[model samples]
Target: MGILSRILNRRADPPRQTRMLEGASGKRWPSTPAFGATGSEVLAGAAQVRGRARHLRFNDPTAANAAEILRTALVGYGATLTSGAEETDSAFADWAAAVHLGELEGEIIDSLATDGEALIILRTDDRGALRLQHVPAEQLDESYTVELGGGRYIAAGIEYDADDQPIAYHFRPARPTDQYQTFRAPIRVVAADVLHLFRRQGAGQTRGLSWFAPVILPLNELSQLQDALQVTAKIQAMMCGFLIDQNGGATSPLGDGESPLDVSLEPGTMRVLPSGWDVRFTTPQQMAQSVELVAVSLRQIAAGLQMPEFLLSGDMRGVNYSSARTALIQFRR
Candidate 1:
């Protein structure tokens, strides 16, 4: 089955929350410490700009219309409008920072030079203070002026070409992908390993009930299975289907003891006895975890079996025994 279909039918789990670090003030500390890049290495790669705008809706008879008006105003200035109080509230802090920076740039540019275009480079310091740099496009070869507190000024050299004009640099805010490069590496690795194991199982003519069951067997047994198939991996990644024969079609409950012959194994000719029944052993969360574990085993099985690409396509469908008879054959080699 396709990814979406699998995801929809897959058992639900509780939301995952991150572990927080507590501070002396007995509050959870923010992870990133500061808003923007700190050192030169970080600053060197910081090329994009961010802008934000906000509007409040008063308790008027036309509150709906007023909210729409505010949304339009924000969107006109390149803000992605979202729904509800909490949605906007969650986004407000980031939006406020961008708006503040944009305002600071506009004010500083208005103050320093009149003739040429001036771009304000606003960066949040390690202490979360907004640092402003005023750059005149025409005199890019010369040093730009940075505004410190209490009339103190610092001159920083601009790292731009002479021909580089300060155009309206539109900000496309960085996403989760941009912020964290190595974030999803572990999950991807796990998924890949699981896929590999299932592929191996497809190569061997093992008539197992489900992909998960055979993989959960003892390591020695796994080795024997691998040896028997002449493959590197011991487990096969097979899709297990649970279907029940009710009325005209399969009507198997997802859990155990609900129907006879509930479980069906794929890519082989093994038929489950008694046609339909719930194979109950664990909770949904446990089942999900088992699915991942089985996936890992299948990778090993595929490697051991030296399965060809066509056999290891990783397509397992769960349906009633009656419904699957014709469909299962098509997937089987």
Candidate 2:
């Protein structure tokens, strides 16, 4: 009777609810970051963001200018490394010259500008000489992570110890086509042998956001609007006037039955019209505001990128020597 009573008193699991957290506005939001997205889902979104940022470097003028500004400030002439030990400094200098570290450093800076992160692999060649290889951040196997006994987690290629300190990196080797290929087992290396440079914003953030990520959407829309304005202006200039006959049954400009006239206008060209025919010109609104609009958009983008507006647009109109110098100094800071 005791055993039967114990079995009968056991409880079953409750049913799951669709609603999660309720905000002040009385709206329910999913109880998860990235809208309840899994780690793999977040990684997929990150991959798309990285690809868009890379393409914007070539396709978007504002992005190109921002990249150049960052490159110049961070590593225009390359960074110099100094060591307290004379012997170590001299030996490293020799190795740097052999590997063209000056040039490679500039490339690394460019990568950071476009991709938001750069990976450097410190390796020893067959002859025992140290070699450095640059790998894209996307190639890091974010899926190859583990959770330790404590509250620490390893998401992506990085492995953190119990104290949340990075201890190792897992990398998928590059393929012959220079594309990222998943390996059966990623190459695991100690954190000391790899340098992962990036700007971290949020606490516990695993990846960096692109430098131009903030202004990308607005800048792209502005660029498209400017292009449309320019095309409209050109079309208005080409179409001067249209000829229309007031009298009925007028002969068409093209020889025989009611054909439309095909004509090209040149600077010094002349055309003769019939007696009852008149040429009416179209008057489009003056687009002087367009110039100001473009300038304002450029200024906003430049401010976001921490660069001088004139430098981004290549226009020095109304900017005197003193103002230019002042802007440059402030931007440097």
Say which candidate scores most in TM-score: 2
Clashes of 1: 36
lDDT of 1 by residue, 1-333 (tens): 999999898878877865554442334445435333233322232121100001101221122232233233223333233566777766765755755644543433232211112334554567775555443322222223344444443222222123332212222222344544232211111111111101122222111111122222332343344354433222232323434443444444444664445455447655453445433332234445555554465456444323321223333444356654554354332
Lowest summed lDDT window (length 10), candidate 1: 48-57
Which digits, one per residue and each the tens of the lDDT, describe model 2 over residues 177-251?
754454567888889999998777555666655666666776777879888998989988888888787886666
Give me the displacement of residue 137 in model 2, in angstroms. 0.7
List per-prediction Cα lDDT, in the order shown.
0.34, 0.76
lDDT score at residue 264, model 2, on the 0-100 scale: 56
Per-model TM values vs. the true structure: 0.16, 0.75
Error of 1 at 18 (Å): 82
